[model samples]
Target: MALSQLEVTGAEVYATQVGDRLTQRGHQVFYVSDTLSCPHKGQHFRLLFNKRSLPRRVWHVLYLIYLILRYKIQLVHAHSRASGWSSYVACKLTNTPMVTSVHGRQPVHRSRKKFHALGYHAVAVCENIAQQIIRDLGVPREQVSVVRNGVDSQQFSPLPAANNDKPIIQIIGRLTGPKGELVYQLLKQCIDLNTNKVQVVSGSHVDKRFAEFEDKVEFCGYSDNIRSTIAQADLIIGAGRVAMEALLCKKPVFAVGEAKALGYISLDNLPAALASNFGDVADDGKTELDIDYSNLAEQLASFGEQHQLSEQLVAAIKAEYDLDAVCQKLLETYQSAYVYTKQQEVPIIMYHRVTQDDSQKGAYGTYVTLERLEEHFQTIKRMGLSPITFSELAEIGLEHRFNHGKRYIILTFDDGYQDNFDLLLPLLKKYQFKAVIYAVTGTDHNRWDVEHPTKPDQRFELMSHQTMREIDQSGYVEIGGHTLNHPKLAELSEAEQQQEIEQNKAELESLLGRELTTFAYPYGNHNQQTKQLAKQAGYTFTVATDSGPIGMHQDLQQIRRIVMFPSTTKFGLWRKIKGNYTYKKASKQARQIDE
Candidate 1:
């Protein structure tokens, strides 16, 4: 595990436990942090400096490269954001796979957008953190997994119920935030009690509020052996890792943290408590808590005097969050990360017509203004992405032959319009780019416009055979079949689908004087039957208008493409290029439309 800081935090504790267990199981484990955190046998440890200094950060990256080369590191698991950032760069430089375990909500800044390309598969410690990484950090939900913190039930097991004599309530972890204030107030509420109570506070980052109660509470500043400290308490008031650990110790816990409280851990609310990450709830979803001091004190005293830990609760924790189970998940996540990193991601951008204006507003989404086309080209260039034709993608994907050392986007112009030849051809030539134009072979005009009820008067002209042939001859363009009359393939019979698909391929090949091997479904509409018909039609690959980035293992028949709208700006184009554009709403609406 690569951790930036070696402090005894939940993330570090998790790393330590995982490493110790893996090493015990005869796996070669290595630790890289500012300080060593291994608890068991000896293992390889490498020192990394603080991330605040630029030179030190670079050194850490270089050291990671060295470690990968020297130790042949198979996978890297980073525990903190600082370490994750540097490790991500190092892994990218060395072509190594990395997975990050975000223990808390990391700040989402604009600069971090560039790292999205690495596609660092994430293991968020909780569901809320998992959601935050997806919603806030722009990570794909498919790429992030939620593996909540697990506790060592063996190490923190419950003591016999006979020791419940005097109430000994403890508060653990960094004494800050609303949890800290709650702890302070709870301690004050119990200071004058005459029930022979003992209160213990254990953690680092002890706040100055403790100075006022120097003689009131027993402060165990910080201890590496927190499980032992937790075992000595009858009840615990904490949240997050502390709450989980205390529960493992068979102590009744009031799950309170950061302005939220679950009051007490019981069988009925156990599932919701775990889903809320053991009461360290997301700010927007925190449960309002009004802790009545006298009542809470009475409950704690009663628990110490009579209540025993529920066997059902202990059994659930062991079944769901056992250390062994969590370790196995980490191993599986690492293997997945390795494969995910190796898969080449290609984000296809689908364009239609490049027109001077949007005077014809019926299909405005398909028409990009000339200026926007130029902006898209420039944005693609600045992002260091080269344009490739569909044939090029097929060669790389199906054959695994050609190796282009740079990122690529398949620039496809669907429903080849005459404006594509006049307006888009120059931009393609200007950028020295390659593109595919899917042309409707049977008609010179969009006949559906005149026949359809939606746009009865909007009969936009499609590119003629002569124009498509000219474009194909340009060496920078490849012609693909877009059906004979641009009918929805799914709505047609199998024979009709084959006619629309196979006949269109034959017509395009006859016009271009070359074999047509690539196809695009008209209106971005297709089903399994439509795809199989395209395969039987002899086309090597086909594309759909699904909004997403393409991967190497993606279906050749149903390639995903992101639509480039007329309203797309330079920044929007950048987001599209990064495959981070927020187009879920647009994508859904697009699927509803024929095109």
Candidate 2:
């Protein structure tokens, strides 16, 4: 069903577990990792080569391509930072679906160069990590899913607390860097833990230097019986999978690692703890070894008080972080990712005013006569193209919605003209077509457009707020943003740009009482700064005046649209939808008439 990019880490452990589960469900699974640590039954494994060896990395990619072709692999899931680079290239080259799981803190450096990681769909192990991926990696939030790493509840189930004179505190993880260094410092500082009976379940990969402190600790090096060993502890300290397993085992877990330390996984702190994926959240790389043994002891002293809390914590774990539930969501992601990567392009048609008379048609390209508008709808229906609103496209994603060779078209009207409500609404209902109308907030006319000297007076009135509300509340319409005051954004200062973009969004959301996530630039004029402002303003997708098909590969901001005029023929509309019409080449002639 899929392949994994792994190393000897918690990410690998998760990948192996998922692979094993997939195999159990009668799906063929393969794993690519640095080493085969605890091979799951009925699964195939391949070495990913040394991390630093360039030749081997190149060879790994080649091998992956071969595997994809040989096994007919449907998807590739990359884990951890090191494997992301190679797997990204391999999947992109092979035209395979790729999903990258951010299991821990990834300090990704921002680059102006093409973002290779952007192409792959992301699965953040936690909500905090998901937001980081969006902020740091510049990946859209829609492209990232929060699927926390899961633990086998049955295997790591809680046992009755063992009798002890004093409270015992333990740290569990591989004896290396983040976990190893932090645990080493904690072990040295807390000598009282020996009398309190501390146990270290060091994983298979151990630093030889850990032997120096062996006499001071009950070092259970490389234990296969982790659950039972963990069951014997009074209080558990660990990170990542260990922390999750500890929580499932009904222990007071102190999550400490390379990421931030979530002091304790309790009912009170459960929400915050879960958001950080039980302490695997990203920090600015400054968190040090800060242990709170007194706090741990205080919680341990009142075992009866924590009894109800323990039940709540376990219930939260099963509800949110259960292995079966997480994997079911992941399977859906895998299927969607495959379809998304192979999606076709769709044409977005833009209009402004629709009127019954041709009197105002020549005054500006904005006006399309009612007959022509009806003809356009008939032509679209005849061609089997389903009309959709921009919000619907944004909600479903261009790829997932348009992937199955489905002929879909978006109908967008700009400037909030009154004629749209009067003349266009009935046509839309007749055709059963969905449309998006971008309203310039608080405006009652196209006041931003200066009247042309040669054209007759075309008094273009805008739809009133009452009319906009009616159309917005209609199931067929989505009200989008055009700006508070329609101004050429490229000509405005950043502050003015913010006022235009952000203020429009705020005003519309306030008026509609629903999120306005799509925007259309005024006169289709904008710069890179304008796009940034729109994104910062929280618009999910923005449309520009440029003419081109909207494909899965297109950026959310600066989505292309084919603006129609009175002269645009049915044949021309057909050509445009088929991607054969060169609108840019014909813009001069159209501009001559409209301008």
Candidate 3:
């Protein structure tokens, strides 16, 4: 389900693109808005009401509840505050997940701060908006994701410009609010109407002040094909999505938005422009306008001659704003929201080595005795908790599996020790439980740890290729990747990290004759870059220690896990599973204090 209050806006375009893509991906989509201006290939429902009316607000909530129940909507994505408040109520009543996209800076008020209506998750179109909501609206930082407005690169690709004596400067925006006033100011004060071919592409009526330059300015109203309109211009004047779309079309943009003016987008000012969402926001987070029309006009004229966008800049924009990548991120957000709504936690138990004797114990205490392992397995069985692999969890979404009301836990053994194949596989088979073994494919020994100067020489043999293949073919165990040499991922350069992560996954998949879906960070140490490398390496789920920033199931790339130490008893295991999130929070806070 998609909800929007505006007829045609950047938020509506985002909804349309996401809805159409989701439809193509074999999912049914529904749109509820005041106007059916969205061209999404989905069922549209009318939601017309005065936002300030008390009775109408109640009616809107009830109507949304009816739509949700009638369509069995799995999720509701609200695009604006008017839709967000009522949808929040409807989703809560219907026990459905909701995601709210914050497109612009929100007004700060005591009432809004008290009831943010951010739903389970809030997506901001830029980092500036994300921070604003967290700081001003009292939305939790963890619940907010920065997902920019995606553009269909193929549809908005570059077009060859036609030569003309005078450059056509097309200004694109809704002719209302600050944008309309900006247009009026530009025409009256900044733009040279006689020297430049000026055109205004807006859906609203032109300001009467523009009557002085009637023949000089052309009005191209509400174009259905914005790309065609964009292609006809020699230069573009807009902000936010308009600036982004023009850049994608390889046209120079004079970045002027609702709040401020970034005279022209160039490599030098691109970072600041992007941070403020191409001038839609200001440095101080105020709504008052900040553009000097005379200075802006002078800069705009000189900018056209000074700036020629490089190929790298265009490629960077395409990659960052790619439609498919944005949709994937949104889908992940949806999944997180759905999981959050379920209010159930899956405890992922992490193990490293299995030992039979006290002599084999290492200083790190990362191993458990074989007998104690079997005892833990017995406790799991006694608790009637089904052990599942990460691959299985990926195949069956968290919501679908948890909806059955059956208890599920994940048992993961990291650094595929030969003892696992020699001893652990039999225990898994005996209990009929599933487990994942993350193997470091490059070496067959614990060289990374053994070679350390200060660490104990706790040398252990890793599983061989044949051993891994046999166990992977067994129904009880799934094989995963744990980097090549088990280096601290945060310490490695990006190229080295990619080589370690991707090469490990590729080798394991080749050896197992199937794709590997899980990865365990070596030493449970990683950073943002390393996490991205893991994702690029094709791992569906990556494991980290309890120190991960987000909740366990919130971030698939860096899932938190329960470390099963050698001293962990049956009671300890039970306590950890029963209160996994509580334990994780305390542990994280404790670690912070220790640090």
Candidate 4:
């Protein structure tokens, strides 16, 4: 992880918490920052650089490159623009993966707009920041993920409110930038310091302007025990992390942040509060730091009677901002980035049916004879390509499997033709290769295509339940879900799609007595709704035919596959597997559509 500042900023705190959690999971984490804080267990390297100076920036880049090489870093998580700029260059030069977390609203400028160093995947701490990066920084929407800042629920659990005649209204944050100005205005004009026992907990020196209220307001300068400070407060005045921490502690929070002021966080206004990251952002895209003083004063005045925390609000916070869930998302993102960086593409070869007779070749050109299948297997072995299942590929990342520069391909047999069990299983055992069979659990034949009047010869027998179980236990074939019955998912209603997808998964898991992780779209036809249903059905990956993002990791739910036909020659299959076949095929189809 690379952070521009080593101070106790939100970004720094987030990185520290993430680093600690990752370390506990038995992963090595390294930090490169402006200074050495070493708050967690990790190797910290300092590479200070002035953002505007060319010489210093170049020096930082070289130092980052050295650190990456020395530590043999697998991925870099950049936190700020200063570190992002340098770390991005180093990652590009070294061929290492990097994911940048947009901690807050970024300043818009020509250079920043043109070349935002958000790495391979940009992680936004909130939806507001994600929008800003995509709109102003010109980042591709697909490359960005909105992962909110997480709070350790255990460490900051709810505490009983202090019983005081005067409520302790504590404002916590660094008294600088727009936040400091907002704090000054709120203290000077908005709140009644005499009636309410106000406290300011900041790392910065108390401004001279705050001298008049010094006696009335308690200025606790930079206490390390932030949770203790928060526990003492009756009402927390902050935004982003502070608001999240306070909410987790079951305290009333006046949502005031650097961007704008959202009066108070309640169950009714919680959605709005979350949309703006508890007021660290303005959802309307307005930059003005406006605060409704009258409304703030009213909320403060009736704080005791109106500002009661609810269990629902606490549950919402825990659901969205739990440290474990957030870390899991980050870890998944890291794995994807690492895979993408390590291997740009993996050939997912798709096959439908294998037969012994050329007379049974269907009109759809979806089958290859057993002789040809064996020839293809020989070619695969001769080319030194190993066939692996999707589950294996996902569990063991590309780097580990591709060690010693070994190449691999995923072999998928769709529709689970009976020949897969009788014919393909022998070849798989002969070569000791693994394959995935996407089985439609509700049927025993290709009725969807065979029942068509124009495609009578396409009739093929699907594997029976006993055959499926036998193949699944063979240790060489993984049975994936292919829906309850093959249907054009795009033409189905949402409920129908859900039923087809979920029911197929449930039945398959029950029959196989194990969970299925991958699903293939029937006829490679799906819409956004179908894809979402597949995800909601718990399939980690869903395959599509020749239509998906250029990279497999780009969209896991809609991965591209190479369709192998009976006429596909050895050289053609090799080209399709080794070359950029998906991209070329997609481009050709796009051109034909345009023409």
Best by TM-score: 4
lDDT of 4 at 523: 86
lDDT of 2 at 225: 65
TM-score of each: 0.54, 0.55, 0.72, 0.79
TM-score of 2: 0.55
Order the candidates by lDDT, highest first. Answer: 4, 3, 1, 2
- Using lDDT as the measure, the top candidate is 4
Q: Against the unseen true structure, what C-alpha lDDT does each candidate score? A: 0.73, 0.72, 0.82, 0.84
Q: How does candidate 4 score on lDDT? A: 0.84
lDDT of 3: 0.82
**Candidate 2 on 1-595: residue-level lDDT in tens?**
2233332467767887877776665566776666665657654545554554888779767877888788777678877555666677778898888888877655666551246363457888888877776776667778888898866777878667756776666777776656677777666653364456777776645567666776667777665667777767777877778877877777777766666666667778777777776666753343354556455455444543444236777878878778888777777777556645643246778899887877776346678889988889989999999888767776665434534345678899998888888888888889999999999985677666645355554568888888888899878789999998788999999999989988888888888899987999998899899989999888888888663233323467887787797888888788777632333433454677698
Q: RMSD of model 3, in Å?
A: 6.4
By TM-score, highest first, what's the ranking?
A: 4, 3, 2, 1
* Model 3 lDDT tens row, 1-595: 4455544688888898988997876567898888767477988888863364889889999999998888778888998888888899889888888999888999999999999888899998888888888888888888888898889999888877647678788999887888888888888888888778999997777677768778889988788888888887888889888998889888888888887888777777888777778888766778799777889778766744755667777787788789999988887787667655754367788998888966788767778999899989988988889999988887766434444346889999999999998889989989999998989988889888788888757789998889889999999999889999999989988999999999988888888888888899987899999989888888888988775633455567888788898888998888777634644564569788999
Q: Write the per-residue lDDT of candidate 4 for residues 40-123, one digit (tens) a residue.
A: 788887778435498988888888888888877878999988889999999999988999998888888898888888788999
Error of 3 at 388 (Å): 5.3
Q: In candidate 3, how many Å is residue 200 off?
A: 1.9
